[model samples]
Target: MHRIFEFDDIIYAVLQHVKSSGTDLVNVAMTCSRLADSALNILWAEQSSLAPLIMCLPQDTWEVTENELGHIVHFSRDPTPIEWERLRKNASRVRRLVGPHGFTDVLKLPRGESFIPDLDVSGYVLQRLFAWSRPATLFPNLCELHFDAVFSLLECSSKYWLLRKFISLGLQALRFDVIDIPTHEAEQLLATLPAEAHGLRQLTVSADDGTMALTVPPSLGKLPKLIGLAIFGIDVCLTRQTIANIQQAWCLQSLKLKLCGTSCDAGGIPLELPSLKTLHLSDGSLPQCTHFLRQVTTPKLSHIDIRYRGSASPAEMTAFIESLSTSCQTGGYLERVHVIDESKIPDPLLIIPLSSEIFRPLFKFNRLSSVKFVGVGNFNLDDGFLYDVPDAWPSIRELKLTSWKRRAIDSVTFTAMMSLASRCRSLQTLHLTVDATQSTIIPRAPDGTEKLWPTQTALRNLHLGYSQVSEVARIPYFLAEVFPTLFDFKWYDYYCGHYDDPDIAMISALSALNDALQELWALRKSAGDHDLDERWEKDSDDSWT
Candidate 1:
C-alpha cells in the first residue's frame, strides 16, 4: 500500500513554521530516506538562527562524558563520539559561535606545553565546525560583533592572544560594555591603532572609572570622513585640550563631552571651531564652563545644548549663558541655545538674581532663536523689570519654561508673555510649566475657576506642565478656551511631592492619559463606520505642515 504525501503543501507549511533554527528540518529529514532526498539543497543550514541552536545543544544533550567519549564528545556530558559527530554535522552551519561560559582560570596549561586540554576542547569544536562548513570566508558578510569582557582574558596569555586575533576582524561597530581593562593595556591598545583604517567612520569609547582613559587618537581627527566624536570620563581640562589638539578636523561636525575632572581654564584656551554645527556640553561645574566657551569658535554653530549637575546657582547660570552669547559674538554664529536646565546648582539666592540679570541681556540677542529651561524656578514676573523679557528676546522663536517651585502666575503677571506675543511677534512656539504645589500660595482665580493662559497670535506648539495626571485631564478644555490655533500639545507630570519614593499614582495618571488618547484616536478612526458625526475627527486632525 502506498501512502499519499502532500509534498508541495508540506514544504510550504515547513517553511512557514520554521521559526526556530533549521535544526528541526534536518531532524525531520533524517526520519526517512525519501524526506532526506526531498529536503536536499534546501539550504536550511544557512538560517541566521543556527548559532543559537548549536550553543544550546550542550545544555540539553546530557549524553557526553569526559572519559568515555575521548575527543568527539569533549563538550558533551556523556561522551558519545558517533552521536557527537551526527550533531556536529547538523550544527556546523553556525559560522560564528559564542560560549555560554567564558574562558576563566587561564586554561592552566603545563609549562612549555603548546596546548591545554579543555582549551583544546573549545578550539577543536570551533575548528571542526569551521573546517566542515568553510566559515572563514563567510565572515566577511559579518559587520557587527559582541563579546563579554571575560576577566580571565586580561591575565590568561593564551586567551589574550586568541582575543587579539579574534577582534582584529574588519568590524564596523564594536561595543565592549563594562569590559574592565588594565589602565596601561587600554592605553596601549588605543595608542597603537593605525588612524588610516577607512572603514571606522563612527567610534564610541566608554568607561566607568578605574579603566584607563580611552584617549582619542590624534590620528582619528585626521580621518577624512570622521564626523562624530563622543568622549566620556576624561578630565574636563584634558578634554578641552584634546579637542584643541584636533582643531583642524574639518570633517568633525558633532561633539559630545562628559568631562570628569576639574573644568578646563578658558583664560588660556581660545575657543575655536570653524566647521562644527552641533555641540553638547554636560559639565556640572559652571566655573569650569567659562573655559569651554572660550575655546569654541564655530562660525557655523547652530545648536548648543547643555546638561550639568545641580550645583550652579541662578547667578552662575546667568553667567554661563552670557559667556555662551559672548562666545557667539566673538567667534561663533550661535543661533540657538537650549539649556536642558538653567540651575546647575540648587542655590536659590544665585538663581533669582541670576534670572534677573540674564533675562535682561538674553532678550537683546537677535541671533538667538530658541531657549528651553528645564527645572528652573524663581523670579517673580510681577516685578516690573521681569515684564521686559518677551521684548528683550525679540528674535526668540521658541521658549520653554519649567518650574521647580510652585508659584502663582496671574494674568496680571502675564505682561511678559503678552509683551513677547505683541513685540517679539517672531515667537512661534511656547512651552510653560506650572507647579500645582503652589496652589495654596498662589491665589486661585475667582469663583473656584481655572484660568486660561494668555493668548498669543503666532503660537503653534504649546506644552503644559501640570502637577498631577488629574490636572492633565483638563487640557482639551484649556486649549480650546485659550489657544484655538495650537497645533501641538504635550503634558508632563511634574511630581512635586516630598516623599520621593516610587509613586505609582503618577504612573497611573500618565497611563490614563495615554489610554484616553488611544481611545480618542480609535474613535476618530471608527467614525466613518456608522456615518456618525465626523467633524470632531476632522477638526482634531492637525495639518500644520
Candidate 2:
C-alpha cells in the first residue's frame, strides 16, 4: 500500500479497489499516522459534523482546542449528560445537534405514547452542544428545527414549556402528530400559538381518530407565512363563512383536511383560494363534500386527493365527482385526483356512478396524469362512473384501483373496467385490484361483429387476487384474453383452483406475486418474443407448493 501511494496512478487504482469492495478508508487510516493524516485532510474538507464531537469532547480538551480544530470530532453516540454540559459551555459553536430517542420527558405523555411526540431529535444534540448558553441555542440563525413532541404539549408539564420554547425558536417547519385531542383543548392550543411565530412556513397536524372532531382556532387563519397546512379529524360543524375566512389567507398553498362526518357549513358564498395549489380531503360523505367544494372557487388549484368514508347513494357519489371535475376544468386548475376509502358501504348509490356512467360524459382529465380509486368494493357503474370512458383525459398516463376485503370486486366491476380502458387512448399504465378469488370476464364479440374491444384490451400492469382467474374462467372461453402490454402482474394470495386450505392459498398467492415480479424484472432487459409462454410458466411455477 505504501509503494502504491508513491504514484498517483497506482494510488487511484488502490482507492478504486477499496471503494468497490465497500471497505471504509477511515478504518484503514486509523492504523497509521501517514494514512490517518491523509484521510484527516480529505475528511476535514467538510466540517458540518464537527460541532457535536467538539461539544462531547472532555472539558479540558475542549478548552485547549483551537477554534479551527473544533470541527474535527464526531460523537460516538447520542450525547451523554457530560457531553451536554460541554455543549452548554461552548454554545456559540453549536449549530446542529441530533439526539438519541427519549432525550426529553415528553415521552411520558399519553399522546406521545399513543401517537407522536414533538421533541426534535436534533434538538437534543443542539441542547447538549449549547448547554453552556441555552439562549444561544435559539433559532435566529437556525434554519430547520424538528420537534416531535409538539403533539404532546397539550398536557400540563415541563414538556409543555419545552413546546413553548420550541415555538419561540423561529423554526420554518413544524410537525405535531397525535392520536386525539379534546375539541376545546385543541382550539385553545391553536389560539395560544403566539401570533409572532407567524414566520412558520409549513405546519402538519394529524390525529388518528376518525370519529373525534377537531375544533381549530380561527386564529390559525392569521398566520402570515403559512404556506402549507394539514389538519386531520376536523369534522366539526364549521360554517361556510369560516372556511372562506381560512381560504382568504393570502399565502396558503397546500391544504389537507380529514373530515369524520358530513357537516361543513361553508356559507352559501363561494370560497376562493387564489394562491392554493394542492388540496387533500379525506373521510367524509361525497355528496356533502361535493356541495362544499362547489362553494370553493380555487382557480390556481392543481391537485386534489379526496377520500370518502360515509355511506351515500351511487348517484350522489357520481354527481359529486362530476361536479368536482367540472369545477377543475372550468378553472383549468386540476392536474390530479385521487379518491380513497376504507368503507365497504354497498349502497348501489355509491358504487354505480363511480364505476359506470358518472365519468363518461365529462371531459377526460386533460391536465391530470394520475388517478386512483382505492378501497372500492360493491361498487356499481351501470349508471354513470362506469359509462364508456371520455377522451378528455389525454394526459392521464397512470391509473390505480385499490380495494380491501374479499368481496370488494365483482364481475360487473371488471366488465366496467374494460370499458374504461377502451376510452383511455393515451393511457400507458393501469393497476387493478380484485380482492377475492374472482375475476370478471368480458366475452369476445360475436364473429363478424364490430366491438369497441373486439379482443382483450392491453394493460401494462395487472394485480389480482388468487381467485381472479377462477372467477374469470367461469365465463365463456371466447372471453379469455391476456393483457397484450402486460409487463408486471401481482397476485395477493393467488391460489390454484384446488387449494384445500384457504389460509395456505392466500400465503401461496402472496409468495407467487413476489416471485413473479422479481423474475420478470430480471428478464425485463432480455430480448424475447416469449412473453406469453414465459408468463404462463412463471404463474405455473408459482403454484407449486
Candidate 3:
C-alpha cells in the first residue's frame, strides 16, 4: 500500500533534492497548484534584482525600445496601474534584495518624455522609481538589502529620502558601496537609522572614491543591535563622547577598518570594546594604529589580522601584540593571528624584517589554532623556533611562514621536522621554508643507527620551500611512513624554479614515494585496520582524538 505525503512534506522533500538548482525548483512550482505555492515561496525568497518582478507587470503599462548598443531600454510612463495584488504576492516572499548594480533597470526607466532624447535617462527614471517605492509596500519581507552603486542617490534629496525609507524597513543587514554624503545629509541619514532600523545587526558603508574621504557621522554609534561594522575609505574622528557612545554598543562582535583614517581628540579618552571578537585593520599608518590600539581594550578579541604597508615599525607591531595579550589574559584566548606585509619592493630583501622575537608574545595564547606570517621581505626565525612551537601552541592546525628571501631561514634539519611532526600531532596544514640544502638523508640515531620517526596521523597537507629536491629526496617516503593520512605534498625552490620541472631525480623519488605509500596502505587494509579509512572519511573535531 502506498501512503500519501502531505503537501508540506512533499515540498520539503522536493526542496531538499533541488536546493542547488533554482531552475528545477521553479519547474516544480509551475507543475501544479499545490506545489506552486511552496516552490514559488522558495524561488522568490532571495531575489538578485527586481527586474523579474517588474517584468511580471502587464505589457500595456510599460514600453520597450532598442538603443544603439543593441540593448533593450524600458520606458514606463506610470507604474501606478501595475497589478498590486499579483506584485505583492511575489514581493512579500523576498527576504534578500541584492542590487550589485543598484536596481538600475527598474530605477533608470524613461518617463513623461514620449520622444526619447539621446541623453542620460537614469535621473528621470530614478525620480519615478523613488516616488513609487516611497510607500514601503514593495518589499515587505526584505531583511537584507545591498546596493553596489549608490552614486546617483547622493545627488538629490528625493533619492536620499527613498534610501531612508528602505533603511526604516528594519533590515537585519544593509551593505552599500561608494556613498558620498555631505555632513548634514549624513546626520539626517543617521538620525532615522536608529529609530527605524533598531534591528539592524550588520552595517557596511564605503566611500565611492579612495581619494575622497567620507566623514562618518557620530550618530551611527546609536545603532543598538549592530554586531558587525565595516567601514572603508572613510575618516572617523573619535571624540571622548563619540568613543563613549561606541562603547555603549555592547553587542558588537566584529570590526574591520580598511583604507580608513581614525583619530581621537587631543584629550579624548581611549575607546574600550570589551565584547569584540574579531578585528581587522589594513592600510593605516603606524601612529594611527598605535593610537587606536592604545585606546581600545578588547578582552574578548580572539582573531586579529593586520596588514602592513611598511609604515609600521617592528617595535610598534610588537607593542600592539603585547597589549592585546595583556588585555585578553584574564579569560580570553586568541585563536588566529595573521600578519602580512603588502609592500611590493623590487628587492624582496629590502622589505621590513619581522624577527622571531616579535612573535614570542603570541606564545602566551596557548589556544592558537592558526598562525600566518607573510612578508614580502625576509622573516627571521631562529633555529630553536620550531622546537618550542609544539609546546607553545599545541592546538595549532594551520601554520604558514612565507618569505621571499630564502637566505633568511636557518638551522632547519631533518630532526627538527620529525620533532614538529611528533609534537604537533593535530597539525593538518603546514607551509614553511626549511634550510635542508646541506642534508641528504633523514637524521640517524646518536649511535648512527636507523632513527624511528613518529607517525603523524592527522597531517594531510605539507609544503616546504627553498629546499633542493636532490638533498631531500627521501622526504616523500619519510612523510608517507610518518603521515599515513597525508595526501598533498608541495616542494619548491622559493627564490627560483618550479618543483614540477622535468628533473629525472625528482620524478624517480616521487614515483618511489607513491609505491611506498600504496604498499603501506595495502598492508593496513590486509591487517583489518579500518580505523585509517574511518579517520579519513569522518570529520573529527580539532581535539585530535
Predictions in order: lDDT:
0.49, 0.51, 0.62
| Model 1 C-alpha lDDT per residue in residues 1-545, reported as the tens digit of each score | 12434465565455445324234555656776655644432432222222223333555442223343132223444424454455443343323233323222212223375532332233434434444443324344333333332112233334333334434335443334323555566555554333323444444455546333444556665555556666655566565566665574567777776656654534454657766777777644665655577666666777888776655566677777777766665322456776654443465344332244555555545566787766644543333443565545557787766555433332122223333444555677765533322111122377977444455556656554432334333434433434444444455644434576744665654565555445543443454434223443444422111
Q: Residue 155 of model 2: what lDDT?
A: 36
The best candidate in terms of TM-score? 3
Query: Between candidates 1 and 3, which one is better according to lDDT?
Result: 3
Please say which candidate is ahead in TM-score: 1 or 2.
2
- Whole-model alpha-carbon lDDT for candidate 1: 0.49
> Candidate 3 has what TM-score?
0.77
User: What is the RMSD, in Å, between candidate 3 and the native fold over all Cα?
Assistant: 7.6
- What tens digits encode model 2's per-residue C-alpha lDDT throughout 1-545? 46656665554455443332212545545766545544432322212232323534554433221233221222345445654564333333332222222122211113333622222223343344444444324333433334343122223333333445556436566665444445555455567653746677777666646656654556777777888888776653663644655674678899887776646564575767778888887767776568667767777778887777655556776777766765554534577777766465544333332454554533444566777766544433341343433345656666765444433334345455565565565565566543223554444576955443534354555555432333332222222333345554555553323456455545544654565455555454343535656665555422110
Encode model 3's per-residue lDDT on 1-545: one tens digit a residue: 12343557866776767644556776777777677788777777765545456555676655555566222325565566456355677877877766442222222334585433222223444455555655256677778877543323235445455566777545989876545456567567666777788788998776636555544555566787889987765453542444465577788898877645445445344566878898877776545555556667777888888775654566776776676676565433689888776654635335456677887878888889988876633555665777889989999998887665555334466557667866798998887765543543455688998776678788876666443333343554566567777755554422333566655544443454445446555655665666766654564332211
lDDT of 2: 0.51
Candidate 1: stretches off by over 4 Å: 1-138, 142-179, 210-215, 263-267, 329-336, 341-353, 359-370, 376-398, 408-412, 415-429, 433-482, 485-545
RMSD of each: 12.4, 10.8, 7.6
What is the descending lDDT order? Answer: 3, 2, 1
Task: Report the Cα lDDT for residue 131, model 1.
Answer: 46
Q: Which ten residues in a row have the lowest lDDT in candidate 2?
A: 100-109
